[model samples]
Target: MSADTQHSSQFALLRQRRFAPFFWTQFLGAGNDNLFKFAFTVLVTYQLQVSWLPGEMAGLVIGALFILPFLLFSATSGQLADKHDKATLIRGLKLLEVAVMVLAAWGFHAQQVPLLLACIFLMGLQSAVFGPVKYAYLPQHLNERELTGGNGMVEMGTFVAILLGNVAGGLLIAIPEVGARWVAWSCIGLALLGWLASLKVPASPSTDPALVINWNPVSETWRNLKLASESKSVFRSILGISWMWFVGAVFLSQFPAFAKDVLHGDEQVASLLLVVFSVGIATGSLLCETLSRRHVEIGLVPVGAIGMSVFAVDLYFASRGLGGGAAYTLAGFVERAAHWRVMIDLALLAFSAGIYSVPMYALIQLRSPASHRARIIAANNILNALFMIASAVLGGALLQLGLTIPQVFLAVGLLNVVVGFYIFLLVPEYLLRFVALIASRCIYRFKVRGDEHIPVQGAAILVANHVSFVDAILLMAASPRPIVFIMDHRIFRIPVLGWLFKLAKAIPIASQKDDPATYERAFAEAERVLRDGDLLCIFPEGAITRDGTLQEFKGGIMKILEQQPVPVVPVALQNLWGSFFSRIEQGTAMVRPFRRGLFSRVGLVAGAAVAPENVSPAGLRERVEQLLAA
Candidate 1:
């Protein structure tokens, strides 16, 4: 097969039985939701008038009703996911959606406000319960390498559905000729299609069959949240995801008003705004999958958050001095090229959101235990709902305090900066990932071959031929798992490099001739780390080579093998020697200045892992030589 076809095959899951059905099922459900919500909203705003609940308050009321189910039912929903078959439960939810749409159809035809509100609440309940199941199902099916791409696809599908659903809703309801009849039937048809699709999704067996179902909403919600907080990284990740939701809720709420009051455009303009945002996000999500080399790189979250703030602030300024009055038609809105900057800002904001969100979902799946993974996902849903509601309340409070719409956008942007920095600080792994990601993107076009050799989940010792100072960094960049390197103790004392070494969790060893205790300590730590099912990388050569050549493999690797009989993966670093970090002396300097320019291409070859019985210092070195030859 061609390389193009081979690369694109990473998304083979989307075409497979395991993933495709679930994808379409959720896609149709999301689209149907927006169809019903917007159809009824337009019905109230344009055709009907009630004293108790004014048309102006429809958006808030609908938003509240939808979010309420997530807050109330998610705790119980988590228990259901962990204790029963996910496919069956998901199918049941789709059937419930069909029933809800039946009610929605009647409400739309009869123009009954109470029945319509009930349908909204029921739709929210379906979404709330499915949230945990939707996210938790990915990790159970896909391999670790496929998780990032799978998530990117799912995220892209969801936003595309949203964009299409809103457009369909607007077209069906707002057009006087077609009106409510078309929208009502469309929603019902969509729901039924979702149910049919759900039937094809493969069964996902429960992890905790004996888990007692938690029935109390209030206390069970707290218990589920506490379970999520058990791991610091997991908890912080939940916070990060929730914060992004809050930011998104704020922006999604403002688009209609922003289009009419700020951009002076009608329904078409609002749809256009959503279109740009959704397309940008979809593009960004796929871009993240490509950039990370299909790894769950948490560093992109920080990148996304920073980009969100920058674009949002720019959006506020772009709207400055632009006068708002009579609504602009679609043709007129597109005529002025200057108005495009505002669209650009909106697109970039959503683009950043795509980057920020995909990795976070993958992280939650990767880190959370399979036994309670669904419950953890449930906790995330609850937090997202609360944060979204808080976003609404906060925006209201700020606007009441005399802030303009553009000013509110500015405030949300600033808050993103503060929230992002706090989360990064809370988890330094994300910060290290930031450094690793930037280094790979800017300093070098780091490439890895034979990454499939790295085991997805197991204890493995990586035996690598280290060519330069940044060998570990380059290897870590290519690896899907966090690798702990065993390095010389003196390297851990090199000022800033030492600080970074500790952050990367490198194991520092000393020569027995110099410090026997440190040398023994390194072996003990290696044993412990491997026992915990983590990857450990060691340079088989005792020292960095003075020339661009391989050295004899040392005996220390045998010592690690003796302590723990984990598999050994031989790795080779290609094109890194003679670089600045390598011990290639130039003139009077040990390391030359700018010998190799920025973004230099380098290769890392991960050879297949050898069983512990076949591993030897010389055998591993020969394996490294064979990989280098390839």
Candidate 2:
């Protein structure tokens, strides 16, 4: 294992030449984008009350202008990223930012509304162009093992930059006489710093150098969507991420009103709420590497969705009863013990949103074809913009219908429950991974060694000793890739586990003596799985062990291997003999819950794959035995 894959080692990426420069460049760009926009919004809202740009309309117009470019230019931007070196594109984009900032400075000095609006649109264009390159660049540089941690770092940095930028803009634009002037200077400086960082970003060569650019966004956007939709998982991930943005936009756009009306707090308290949210998301982003165990673990998605809904619902209840009262200062808000629950709810909800998003992003990066990765990401951006816009519309409609802000929160939280279930059911892989995660993290203190022996791609047959009912689940958690287990049909009737196995599409086999047709079909299906270059796992012992000993390997595995000739990997489940899932007392399993206590030690050790011709049932058994003993 590389040191960079360890917990907290994601921070070490900041010191690496390949990652640091790109990180800072993107970081500054995000910060500058928010800084410029917020300052302008503040200018229009507080400093100058133009009839065309009322305070109520300032944020809306600025936001619309900013996101408009994404809708118009994302497809073209994606093509550019695929067709040219990303480092070169990044440097050029930074230069554009510098020019935009220079113009913004002039607009601020002269108080030119049209010019400032143009600047917002121009900044948005720059961001649209950079989005595809930003995601596409990471996969080119980082290996699969580093993808999750790297994505976590970027996600964390982007949110942190956004928070800092908003804070800086609000602070500088509030200065007595020189606020706008200071904002202009800061924007320009940040642009220059981003350009400087881009200068050091190593070359990320084009994935498709011969690709033709399509300047028409209308046709290209549709084409991009179709291209992404070709891969169901990748497309669904894009949709899932877009939905997250939808939820986030709803909550974020409401913070000001939620704090002012519901919590009865001043501007300072609203800012405090934003601070908590940003920090919570950043904390959750950094935690992904550890929770995912250095892989693109989609299991965390469901877990995150649960936290998001629970906290959002609780937040509604936490602030529902607070009536109109004296506006509290930041410190005053904190002084009230009743308000702490609101803060906690907001923090945990934001944190859950963070956990929910990073994995989907990573999955998209990993699964999308390399040649069109940027275009798919562009499709994702277009979807995100649309979703966020829909969020604005939805929030407005709900509030217009006389629902209080807290009620809106309640609506979104409940809606999330529906959306989360719909998406997870559509993609059963995510649901199965969640089940595996629960098995490994909650039921057992699970550890896996030699997981690298499991093939990252192509065909492989995994033969393991079945010590307990949950052995396949623990094995699933251990391997990065999904496994199609050939399990006894009898286990398919064990209630919840059976349903999950069916969802996972595990093939069920019966003893040939009792059911010849089912037995033959199982082997044929297992063979077909290997032929299709997917992982197939078989518990050769056939059933959960009645005693704490390795049962003799069965010939069913040999029958499948004889036809498929795929590499067979040996795996052993250790320290599970006395577990609740194991038949340890009176030949019954799961009779005494917590027999080994929660998170009791358990391990999965995978040995190197044995060649097809050299493999035998006895040989595989000995290999698993060696692994268990080791």
TM-score for model 1?
Answer: 0.93
Q: Where's the lowest-lDDT run of ten residues in candidate 1?
A: 1-10
Screening candidate 2 with a backbone cut-off below 3 angstroms (N, C-alpha, C), the clashing residue pairs are none
Q: List the candidate 2 regions with Cα displacement exceeding 4 Å.
A: 1-8, 261-266, 321-328
lDDT value, residue 175 of candidate 2: 85
245-305, model 1: which lDDT tens digit per residue? 8998787766666776778887777778878988889888877778788888887888999
lDDT assessment of candidate 1: 0.85
lDDT tens string, model 2, 328-444? 978889998889999999899989998999999999998888999999999999998888778778877887789988898889999999999999999999999999998899878
For candidate 1, list the clashing residue pairs, or say none: none
Model 2 worst lDDT window (10 residues): 1-10
**Superposition error at 409 for model 1 (Å):** 1.5
